[model samples]
Target: MKKKTFVLVVIALVSVGFSAMGQRVDRTNFKAGIHGGVPFGDISDHSNFELGLDVGYHIALSELIDTGLTTGFMNAFINNDSVDAGPVTVEGDFPNIQYVPVAAVFRLYPTYDFKLGADVGYAVGINDGNTGGGYLRPIIGVNVSGNTELNISYVKVSDDYDFSMAALGILFLF
Candidate 1:
């Protein structure tokens, strides 16, 4: 009975020690950002620039790696003249195309100021008759200030039609 009690206590102590070691009070726990850029490929024919905003919470998985959940809103301004249906045609400027992206983000920090990351998940469309699709964004970032980071990324969305964009953004960590 005493031997069993000692083993249980030892296991508890080791678990507590490891948990304590994982605690760091100096790291930023949350981040938010805004970005703008131009769309390419087939989307460019209908839209011009794209704008977006994102927020996330991150946990350090290791000294050089972090993983998190992120979500954002992005919109592309439409510039088409008219649309044709089976027998009817509508002639007017339309609403902007919007997407809400929810993704898992993995970041690899090679240095205190430089990082590379990828976001993979799905983007939901916010327009009528538009279906959502899977998305992939690969990014490179540089910490320009203590709490501010600048990043450039390529975003791709795979739906009935594929679209892509190149974006530059700034993130504020807290």
Candidate 2:
């Protein structure tokens, strides 16, 4: 089910990009960044901090709107010395909970220097399958300098166990 949804999203985004190919537009932007944040909810019970990397491509849809594709890797570092599974208790350290998020991104730029955006997509787990979920992230951004942007975002991932994070990051645009 998750794989099907992911394929559909990729197809839709690709179609949109192709349809926009003939339009004369401002400019497209490519951005990459790193972010760090604290985990909340069920995740907080086991994790202390989260770190991630993101890359995105945004094309101007209008003076005020932009649509794009974004994908990234996020990991929540574990805190417990051991984990209990059913009647069995496993000792020693475990690997961080990791996710790979692939999403459609939309941005509303009220001004050239300020923007609000959201990323809606699926996050796939990399280990132990503890974090695979659907994710929504709302972000606020400011252009601190030419081609440099600073952003703060709240990310919510919904699954069997829901979790959230508050992230601050800087992106370099090209």
Candidate 3:
């Protein structure tokens, strides 16, 4: 009975020690990655592809879990000619709009080379061309190495058209 009590005491002490050091552990746990990929969607009839770039930082929340902040840039192309102006074909320039997406991200690393996660955030449209409203993105990726990953995701935007985009890219983690 005494032996059992001693073991329990040791386990309790160890658990307390770990919890106390949790902050320290997180303080030293950090990661970053850069990814760029071609996004595909119905933004334009002849757009073909668009460029995307993402840079983010990760804070280790647990052994297999992490939470952090992410910001990304997307050069979105869309065909404006679809909006036919009555009788005349309006020759309006189709500008590539820049999109900046910022979010609070959470990740779950299931394997050494794989991670699955989701992010909730907003996509702010740059330039006066188009102002997209709020956005929600669900992300999935595979880590190529300790500091690199490839990701694919779907982003839903709050707009009159309710636009959505599919993003695919590779990120270099730092």
Candidate 4:
């Protein structure tokens, strides 16, 4: 069921993306891109890094203002090699987690092929092989081109889990 929902969401997004690009191909100057980067931070008291990839699409609403969507997936893993692993580390389950974030972005100054933006959204995570709780994230980023960007963000998770992360990445546009 969840897999089906995820697939449907991807398909719908792709359809909308194609139609949107077709509509903007002549007068709107639309730009769609993807990015990949490493996530640096601690989640749920586990000090592990995450690897992630994201996609975004933008249409010039004006010379300096544009609205778009950003979607991403990340995998986080924690290593427990010590005999005295933390209390949170238990048997029969591991600490590998996955997160998917979908957001709406408002961008400024994308014409120089470099841009800065703010993002507001929620992230859904799967933990220990089960769907976990959600989070709220506030993000800021710089796009050096349609294909490259760097971002920093703060994510707030339930029950006092929180952290900040920085990502350096490249995006491809078509």
lDDT of each: 0.79, 0.84, 0.62, 0.53
Best by lDDT: 2
Runs of candidate 2 exceeding 4 Å displacement: 1-25, 83-92
Q: What lDDT is obtained when candidate 3 is compared to the true structure?
A: 0.62
TM-score of 4: 0.60
Which lDDT tens digits does candidate 4 get at residues 1-174?
Answer: 655664465456545544544544333433433333333434534544656677766765567765566767766555554323456645544556667766555667745655666644546665544453334445556666555555555554332244345554555556
Error of 2 at 73 (Å): 0.7
* Model with the higher TM-score, candidate 2 or 4: 2
Best by TM-score: 2
TM-score of each model, paired residue for residue: 0.79, 0.84, 0.70, 0.60
Sorted on lDDT, highest at the top, how do the candidates line up?
2, 1, 3, 4
1-174, model 3: which lDDT tens digit per residue?
A: 643564465345434434544544544333444433344433544354556667665666677776666677767565454444458565666677567876666678897677788765666788576775555778888877666677888876654444566777777755
Per model, how many backbone clashes are there? Answer: 0, 0, 9, 1
TM-score of 2: 0.84
**Superposed Cα deviation of residue 171, candidate 1 (Å):** 0.6
The deviation in Å at residue 66 for candidate 1 is 0.4
Residue range 1-93, candidate 1, lDDT tens digits: 643564465345444433533665345358999999799987887788999998876667678877666788999888777655449888886
Tell me model 4's lDDT, rounded to 2 decimals. Answer: 0.53
